[model samples]
Target chain A: MAARLARAPGISLQHSIRHAAILLVAGRYRDTDRSALCRLHDQLPQPRATAWWGAAPLTDVHDPVTIAEGDDPVPQLRRLDRDLLRGARASEPDWLPDEPPNAWRGKGDHGQGGKGMMGGVPYGRPMAMMGEEMRDGLMLDAMTVTIGPFLRTLPPGLSLELTLQGDVIQQARVATPAYSASGIASEPLLRAARILELLGLPDLARRARISAARGDDDEGLVAAARRRGALLALPADLADVRARLDAALRRGAAPDPGEECLVDRLAGMEWQSALLRVASFDPATLSRIAPAAEPEEGEEEKAA
Target chain B: MTAADLAFYVLSAVAVVSGWRVFRTDSMVRASFLLMLSFIAVAAIMLMLAAPYIGMATVFMMAVEMMVMALFMVMFMMNPAGLNPMSMVHQNRLSIGAAATAFVGLTVAVLFTDLPHEKVARQAPVIRDLGHELLGPSMLVFESAGVTLLAAMVASVVLSARSGRFGPSDEGSRPPGLEPGGEPAGRVPESEQEDE
Candidate 1:
C-alpha cells in the first residue's frame, strides 16, 4: 500500500478505498459471516464495488506489551500553563477593538486576501485608502455641533443617543423617563446589596434586613437571625477564630460579645493560617498543658 | 538459545508476536497501543537491521494517530473514559481463516524460494541511504500527507461543528445570543427562575 501510495499517487481514491477496506478488516470477526460481508460492502468506495483487501489476508498480531508490566518509558507531561498565560498577555494589541467582535476571532486584519508579508497593508495600499475614506465619511456638517462628554454618562433607566466621529466619541444626548425615581427610596437598596456582596453574605444579609424592615419582629426569629449573622461574621480561619475564642476565655471576656466594625480586621486573613494557630491549643491541649485531668484507673495503660 | 541468539530471537519473537497482537486485540484503542509496542520492537529490530527513519516514522505517525483516536473517543463516547470491551469481530471466520492460510502459505513459499546472492562488502551505511530515500520521492508523500491532514481537519469541523463564525442556526439550531463580554447575563428573567 505504501509502495502504491508512493508510486502513482495524486490523491488516489482507489488507494483510500483499499486503505479503508484494510481498516475494516483490521477488526476482529464476531459474527464473521454476515457483519464482515456488510463491512466489506461499506469498505468499498463505490456501491458496485471492486476493491477488496486484495491478496493481503489479515492475521492476528499477538501483542506481548499488553500483558507486560507498566507503561513504556516516556517523558512526563510538560507544563504549558505558563506559556499559555504569556501568549494571552502578549496578544493584547492597541489597534484592536476594546471588546472585540468575538473572543475566538478578535477584530484586526482578519481577511484581506494577501498574507502578513506586507506589514498589515494589502498589496497596492488599498486598505490605507479605505481607512482614510472611513475617516472622511465620519465627519459631516450635521454632526459638527458641541455635545459635552458628560452626556455619555446616562443615569440608570435613562436612554442615550450617540454620535461618533470615526470610531471616536463625538457627541451624546441623554433622555430620562419622567417620575422614574418617585417610588424609589432615598437609600439605594442596591448599596446595601453591594455592601453585603462585598461582605460575602449577600443572601442572608439581604433577607435579614428585609425581614426586619418589614416589621415581622418575632423575637425568636430576630434572635436566630442575629445569632446566625454573628456566627457568619466569625472569620473562616478556624485557627484565628479558635485563638480569639481562647484568648477571650483566658482574659475572662464574654465569648459572645457584640463586635460590630470588626470586619476590617478580619478581612483578607488567610483561613488556614488562622486555623493552624487556633487549633494549636484547643480544650484538650489546654488541659494537657495545665495537667487538669483527674487521675483514673488504667491511665498508665492509656498513656502507653 | 545462546544469549546473542536468545536476544535476537526474543526481540524477533516479541516484534512478530506484538505485530500479530496488533491485529488480534479486540479494542481499537488497545489495538493501537499494542501496535505502538510492536512498532517500537520492530524499530529495535530496524536498529539491528540498520534503518532508523522508517522505524521512527512508524512510531511517530502511529502515536499521533492513536492520540487523535483517543481524543475522538473522549469527545464522542457517553462514558468517555470508561473501559468497556468493544469487539470489532465480524462474520467471516472460515473465509478469514482460509485467506490467512493462503497468505501465510504464499509468504512461506517466498521464504523457501532460492535466489542468487550478491557478494559486495557492506560499505554504504543503511540508515543514510534510507534517509536519502525518504527525502527523495517520499518527501512529496510526506508533504501531501500533511495537506491531507489539514483537509481532513477542515472537512471534519465543517461536517461536525454546529456553530461557525456566522451563527449556530446555519446548522439547524437556535442562534445563541451574544453577550458583550460573552459572559452570561447577570440578571435572571422571572420566567427562567426556580425556587432555591
Candidate 2:
C-alpha cells in the first residue's frame, strides 16, 4: 500500500514529518503505537491535516477525513492537501501536549546545570558517556538510540535499540519484531524497487513498481537499472546485499534463512549500510533472524 | 564612511560573531557549520581586499572541510541535534588561555608591525599571476601531492573491503562464481586451489 502511494502521481511520500503537510494514517496500528502516532501527528508543520486511509481515526483527531477500503486514496489525499493549503479546511491540532520531555535544570552561568564542563544533565537527559570503541581501542562517546517502529527504511513495526560509535553501530537489539508480511510486501519486484530507491535510483524504482503493478516481467527495468549503475552504487564490501538485490531484480526465490543472528550481522556496519542490509531481507527471514528482546520496565511509554 | 569600508566592517563583525558562536552553539553539527560561515565571511573580506583566487579558494576549501567536519560531528557527538543542550568543549580553561594569548599576539602584530601600503592596481591580473606562480616552478610538487592523495583514497577503499583476495571475509559471504559450479571469480589463494 505504501509502495503504491509512492508511485502515485503528485503524491510524494516523505521520510521526515517536517517535510510533510498531511499525516496519512493507513492500515491498523497496535494500541501501544497510539502515543507514537500522536507524536508524529504533532511533528507535522502547520496547515496540516490527517487523512486516514482504510484505517480508523485516532480518538483525539477532530473530524478526521476517512477513506474507505478498496477505494483509491490518491484523489482524497490530493484534495485534503489542496483544501488545507487553500485554507478551506481547518488545520489539525496537535494531539500531544506542547511540553518538554524532561524539566530544564541548568544552574551554571550558561545554564549547563553542572559543575565545570561535563557534570550534570543540562536539560533532563544525561550527556552521552564514553564507551570502549568497537573498531579501535580508543574510548569514545557511544550513544544508545531507539530508531523506529515506522522509519521508512526499515520494515513496519520494526524498532531497534542501536548503540553507536561514530557512524558505526557498536551493538543492536530488536525492541520489537516487524509485523508479519502481507503478500504484496513480499513481491520480488516491490522488494527490488525498495532496494533501488535506497540506492538513489528513484526513477528506476518507479519503473519497477509500475512494471510490478502491470504484472510485467521487468527485464527492461532490470537492464535500465544496470545501465544506470544501480548495482555499482552499493558497497562492494556488502556482497550479500548485492546478491539479494540481484536475486530480487531477477525474481528469484528468497535466500535461504541463515543461522546468524540479525543483531550480529548489523553490528560494526555504518548506519546507512546496516539499513541497506536490513532492507535486503524478506520480512519472514528478518523476523527469523531478529527475535524481539524482552521489553524493559516503562519501555512501553517511550516513543523514539 | 565609504560603501566598501562599511561592507568590510559588517563582514568583520559577521566573521567574529559567527566564530564566537562556533563555541557557544550546543550542537556540534551547528558549530562546524557556524565555523564554515565565519570562514565564508572572512573569504568575502578577502575578495573585497582584491585577492579573488585566495578568497574563492578559501570558500571552496572551507565548504568541503566544514561539510566533512559536520558529518564527523554528527557521527561522533552525543545528542548531535542539541536536544539535551550540552557543552562541546573540554579543558575549557586551557583553551581560553591559549585563545586569549593568540588573539593578543595577532592584535599586537596587526597594530604594530610595518605593513605594505601599496595598493594592487585595479586592472592587475592577480588570479592569473597566482596561477602562474603555483603551476610554474612548483608544478611537479603539486602534481605529485595530488597523485599521492588519489593513491591514498584508493588504498583506503581497498583496505576497507570486507572480502579479501584470499576468500570471503565472513561465514555469511558467498562470492559469486564466473560460471555455474565453477571457482569464484577474482584471485584465489594457492592453498584453496590445492584443497579444491
Candidate 3:
C-alpha cells in the first residue's frame, strides 16, 4: 500500500510553464511532483520565433560572417558557432547549409546584390574591394532578411514563443499577445485583426485594426466587442465600404476612371479569387517596400 | 522447576511481548526488532525441549542471523537506525478479525489436545553420551556438519553483501600511488566529494 501511494503520479499543481520549468531544472521533486510538472510543461503552448534573424546565404570563396563592420577597435566577439562546418560533408542533409552556398552579402539593391546573407553583413568575410561608388551601390543592394516571410504564412493571431534545441527549434509556445497596450501587430489579436482586414473583412476587421492603429492592442475582447457593437450601430451598406476603400486608395492621387472600373470589377469577383489575387500581390509589394538593388561591379570581371 | 519448563515459560513470555510490540510500535525499525525478538524467543523455546542438538544450535545460529537482520534494518529502509513508523497492518479492523479468528481456533485445539507426557529413557544427561557416540563411529558425520555450517555462513554473507565496495584487491603490493589509508594522498572525504 505504501509502495502504491509512492508510485501514484500526482495531479499537476503547477499552473504555469515558468513554474514547471523551475521544477524541471531543480529535479529534487518526487516522481509524482515531477510527473505533474512534466505534464504542465507539455501542456504549455509551443513558442514561435516572434522575430528571427532569417537564413544567411552561404558561399565558398568568402565564408559568411555576421557582424558589424565599423572602423573602431572591435571588442572580442564571442564564438557563437560551435563546430561550424569547415567544408562540405558527403551526406548533405536538407537542414544543413545549402550547397553552392550563396555567401551572404550585406543588404543591397535588387539584382545588384552579390551574395547570400543575413542582416547587412556577409556572414564570415568582408566584401571584395570595389570602387567607391560601386561599393555604396553594393551596400544598398544587399537584402534585409525579414522574419516576416516565414511568419506571414503562419495562422495569424496565435501567440507564439520559441525554444531552440541546439540550432534546431525544439519547441514553440503559442499564445495571443492580446494584452499589449501598444496596439502593435506584435500582439496576435491585432495581427489577426489586421490580416482579416487585409483579407477584406471590413466591418469585422476594422474594430481591432482601428484599436490597434490607435495603439490599444490591449483592448480586451469585451471592449473590442463593444467597439464592434458601435461600428455595427452605424448605418452601413456595401456602398459605404466601397466609398471608404476608394477614398483611401485615392488619397495619394486622383482616381483614374479606367483603374477605378477595373478595381470595381475585381472587387465584385468571388472572395476566393480575390484572396488569390491579394496573395499574388505580396512578393511585388514586399519587393517594392524593401527593394533589392542589382550587383554594381563583378569582381571576377574587374580582375579579368 | 525444570530447566525446560523455566526456559519454556521465559520464551513464551518473550514471544507474547514481542508479538504485542510488533503491532503497538509505530516505527518500522522497532516493529522489525520486535519481530526478531519473537523469532529468537521461539528458537529458545525449541532449544528448551530436550532438543539440545537443535535447541542450542538454533539459539547460536538465529542470534547471529538476527543481529545481521538488525543491521539491515539500520541500513536500507529510510531513517536507518531511527524509529520510523512502519505498520504493515493498514486495515486494522480486517486484520483484527482475521487474527482473532486464527488465535481462537489454535487456542481451542491446544486446550483440547490429549498431549503425551513421556518418561525419559536415560538417567544422565544425553550430551556426554552423545559426544562419545559421535566421536566413535560418527566422526565423519560430525565433520560434515561442520563443513556444511561453514559453507552456509560463507553463502549467507556473500548473498547479503552488495557488490565490491572494497573494489579489486590491489596487487599484493599497493598500486603506484595509494597511501597507507588505502587512498590517494590529499583525497577529500567521500561526504565532501558528494557535496561538490
What tens-digit string does per-residue lDDT give for candidate 1 at A1-304?
Answer: 1111112222222212333211212111222222323433343432121111221222222211110112211111011212223442121112222442223222234443223322332322212111111222211222222221111111112222334333332333332211122232311222222223333554543443343334343234324434546335555544344334334222222233233222122223343232222222223332232233232111000000
- The best candidate in terms of TM-score: 2
Regions of model 3 farther than 4 Å from truth: A1-304, B1-11, B39-57, B81-84, B89-117, B121-123, B132-147, B150-196
Candidate 1 wrongly placed segments (more than 4 Å): A1-304, B1-5, B16-31, B74-88, B92-123, B126-150, B160-163, B168-170, B173-196
Interface alpha-carbon RMSD, every candidate: 22.6, 4.9, 32.6
lDDT of 1 at B132: 80
Could you give the candidate ranking by TM-score, starting with the highest?
2, 1, 3
| Local lDDT at A166 for model 2 | 74
Write the residue-wise lDDT of candidate 2 on B106-170 in tens digits: 99999999999999988899978877877998799889999999999989767555556665443
**DockQ each:** 0.01, 0.13, 0.00
Give the share of true interchain contacts found in each model: 0.00, 0.13, 0.00
* Leading candidate by DockQ: 2
TM-score of chain A of each: 0.17, 0.89, 0.17
> What is the lDDT, from 0 to 100, of the residue B47 in candidate 3?
55
| TM-score between candidate 1 and the true structure | 0.29
